[model samples]
Target chain A: MTEAVAIENLSVTFTGGSKPVRAVDGVSLSLGQGEVLALLGESGSGKSVTLRSLLRLHPPKRSRMTGSIRVAGRDVLELSPGELADFRGGVVSMIFQEPMLALDPVYTVGAQITEAIRRHEKISAADARKRALALFERVRIPSPDRRLDAYPHEMSGGMRQRAMIALALACRPSVLLADEPTTALDATVQIQILLLLRELQRELGLSIIFVTHDIGVAVEIADRIAVMYAGRVVESGSVRDVIRGPRHPYTRGLLASRVERAQKGDRLETIPGSPPDLTALPPGCAFAPRCSLAAPQCREIVPPLAEVGPAHTAACIRVAETV
Target chain B: MIIGEPAHLPDGPDRGGPAQPLLSVRDLVKHFPVKGKGLFGKGAVVRAVDGVSFDIRKGETLGVVGESGCGKSTTARLLMHLIKADSGEMVFDGEKVGADLDLTAYRRQVQMVFQDSYASLNPRLTIEESIAYGPQVHGVSAAKARAKAHDLLARVGLEPGRFAGRYPHELSGGQRQRINIARALALEPRLVILDEAVSALDKSVEAQVLNLLQDLKDEFGLTYVFISHDLNVVKFIVDRVMVMYLGKVAEIGEGPAVFGAPRHPYTAALLASMPKMDPDARSAEAPLTGDPPNPINPPSGCRFHTRCALAEPVCSVQEPPLAAMEGLQEAACLMALPGSGHSRAPAPVEAAA
Candidate 1:
């Protein structure tokens, strides 16, 4: 069986400024059908960049890409301009962190979803409206009929996000890209949306790539976890392995730095330094400067991902069991 | 537990008289009028904060938590005087604000650090200049202010020599937030209101900043009104926790009591809403459904009744008062008090429990 999404050595560099920023560097990832893979990282870690590359969403004038991306059996990188446009939303749809900014303010929520459905298929407006109402019901939006006519601004934050999910799913894409969809919401609202997504993913057998910096959210929704740092996948494994037995020094630091890891009134263990500059990352391991176990050799060579457990892989020579 | 009593402070430079609360707010209320709506316009007022009252003790971190539009930020802004309140009274160190202590003097005693570090600082100013500007405006000598800024820079773990001359744009988000903390401290404030100050940082960076804040609090004997939506962070740092819903305090108590055994249904639901860190223990069902209701003319009584799992008919008719419970905890729930007309309320004999 073919994978829902496959990426190989994806390198994306933004070249607008004098010094180019290698946003994503030699990152490879794959997701099976109906699997939920979380691209976990802090800001500037390039998780979002890798997700966007699959859709060819970057500005052509400023960004240069040099890697192959395949999604749902289509060669994303090889697709023509027009075909790329068709591939977007028709085969792969994405939901953003902020629904207020993502949804069209002028159009009613139902109108937007109906237009999205009509955009990919030759369905009548009436049928599309019916489909849109069904989607609203599917996402459990209150008062589906009244909510359909309400504009994005008229709805509350959580309501707006439900509409966003309805719109994203309107085209019936096999793969979904969720970029921190719950980060902007409160804990109560976040869990509701998360549960909704999990139910929908299972019900529809949809493959999903979720990008978020929040570990708890990742643990709640993702089956596989990929920890990114300095534009590389430092660790990737089942959620249990990554969270319970994090191998990468950066990933370990991230887990230890959380509030629950420290006793009350105790100083939280930190990574000691900020992320490396994307434009001027060190020649070897970018995290070596801040890593506690860094040795002389660790700074001179960039470690490759090696198997630690049956399914776990980490990019640190010291921690890699294969060595 | 009430919202009307005003405290009296003794006239002196010494802050926080022997048993006095560092700051006390009474009947704090703020209602932002909607566009094209007058003060008396039909349901025009967005009751962002309605009659919130609390006391801040010296040297303790008081956390303010709630969902968005729950009036957490509005309450902070009112405390900071960033926005005028419709009705309220504040007593700082037992002295009534505006009456006993002037606005400028009151402001000097209290400082605020916002979430957006870059937007809060002046773009043209260097790190040292930004920190020193507060003291300079308050009539401190320029050289002394600069000297203090350098000392604070070192204290916050930023080497003064390296960071002082750099502009805001040159520093990272974590570094800029440190500068904001330094700026807040330059005035020698007794109370600091950190409104989601660490929310924007990464886990690693947030840990570092939180440590810095704890150290600063100890060194300066600072009282903190730490407002955030992250319950884990709040449970870790604050001595006391206040849970707000629809601009009203639902629960306020010692940290352990509020988190371990909450009396209010809203508080219980909020605690349950936290996603467990363990992957195997993912919650099967959502804690509470539906978004927080709009602030405009919120539900008739007990603002949380609409979504609360344990809400009864009385919850929508009569608002529960903040009844004092054991362990110095207070909750505005009918179930916490005996014979409050709710079937699930504690028995009169069990009221002492």
Candidate 2:
């Protein structure tokens, strides 16, 4: 499969007062065509920053990004202002966590979708409208004809999300970046949206970068998983291998912390310490303070991603020695 | 009207001993009128907690689980009397609750833990002051309240020396939530209503709080009305469960029984919808289809009929009453009834390996 999106040695740093805070440390990842990659992490794990940086949406003056990001054979970071604007929605599209905030309340859903389509493609207004309605129907919005006239506020949360997905797919971008797409939705609605995404991915052959804090969501949708901590990918592998037998201590801690997995009468095993503050990270492995398998060496030097098995890698000093 | 010989009800668990329950609620309704008028030219009621009724035992955790707008939070508010119910009967400890009901006395016995830790606590007030507020209001002396607050803080696993003087803004989310729990316990309330208490927390933090709640319940002999949207958490914390849809109870039973063998289609669907943490245990059940019906003009007969997988013609024609099955299970669904064609067989208990 062709690489739909690729990032090499990406690093983002912000200058605050005297010290420079590295929000996203040196990282590298690639998504194949029609593949879904889950960027799993907690709130301030820099998953959002990494995703934003890929599209060149970060604040340029305050934040400095050093990386090579290629999307559909186009160097996203090197694109000129005119080319960036034309290439953004034409080759890659993004869907945020909150659909209502992303959608325009003043305009009808159909009008907004048609406008998105027209921005990327040279089409008549009537043709765009026709295509928009078709897109809405494809996203499984019931009674597309009537829903096209409804505003974002008029639609239910699930319907609004579906409309958002339709809008993102308006130009049929090869790469779709969805950041916490199902977090705001109900459990049932989340399942529906996930299934819809899977269906669309297969039909359109689109590569998706799905980011979420919930590990359950990542397990359900992602073909490959990349666990992020302290702005760096700690582990990366096929979902099956990573989930069944996680090599990283942080990943193991996360899996063990779930209430569902604990024995009926046993207490949940929580990771000892809190996530490290990005502003003042420790000298060595960021997760050393909280890691159960940490030794003196773990706190002295940072570990790079070491191959644990076929197509699986984890950044841990004890991966080979333990288990 | 003739006064009863004794208003106090029997405490024993018998079939039919007394009519008075430890806590009795009848036809509890709370409506928030919408501000703007539509084409109808009149404000509409939000129907937050419409006609909710359930009894709570002296020392039992009654878990309330529902989606965002299913009125779980509103029900908690009504029970706490934080807001007045539009119309209903609320009897606490066999005494009627009303405007004239001694709020200070009631507040001492029935405390609440809110969802948002940031908004619930006063930023200016220190942890000790916040926890002492309830005790002080109920006639405890300032010195006594301070001592009680210190003990409560310790009970929730926070070191009094380090955390008692810290303000709400200075604490982490988990620490703030511990203070919230400590404050709720300051008055030694018999019942504690935790409304989405741990929903906003991280998984590890949530687990810690839940374990703390369980430990406190055992130590203090406390009863909890645990309200939440996450069924897994509810199952972990509660002994008995109450599933709510729209503004009504969909199912009520022992936690294991209800979770292991759900009778109502809504209950089953909710269980199916929950993302299983263990990939091996993923259910083969079909996904729930369609959105929840609008509560403003909910489906006529059954509020869940629009999305229920086993919905029948009768479900849309008439509302099913909450009926008791054999043992300790009760469900508000025609299919769960004994005579109904869709009646499920008794679940076989798994033996210890």
Which candidate wins on lDDT?
1
Question: Which run of 10 residues does model 2 chain B get worst, by summed lDDT?
Answer: B1-10
For each candidate in turn, give its C-alpha RMSD to the true structure in angstroms.
Answer: 4.0, 5.3
In model 2, the runs with Cα more than 4 Å from the true position are A16-20, B1-22, B39-43, B99-101, B277-286, B338-353
**Which ten-residue region of model 1 chain A has the weakest summed lDDT?**
A314-323
Rate residue B312 of model 2 by lDDT: 70
lDDT by residue (A1-323, candidate 1, tens digit) is: 45999998999999999999999999999999999999999999999999989899999999999988888777898999889777888899999999999998898988899988888899999999999999999999988999999989888888989999999999999999999999999999999999999999999999999999999999999999999998999999999999989999898889989997666799888889888789889878989999888888988998998889898999997794223
Candidate 1's iRMSD: 0.7
Going through the candidates in the order shown, the clash numbers are 1, 0
TM-score, cand. 2 vs. native: 0.92
Estimate every model's Cα lDDT from 0 to 1.
0.90, 0.82
- Candidate 1 lDDT at B123 equals 95
lDDT of 1: 0.90
Candidate 1 residue-wise lDDT, B1-353, digit = tens: 11121111222444666578888899999998788754346658889999999999878999999999999999999999889889989998868988987787788778999999999999999999999987777777788889999999999999999999999999999999999999999888888999999999988899999999999999977889999999999999999999999999999999998999999888888888888899889989988999888888799878898998888899899888888988879999888878878899877875353
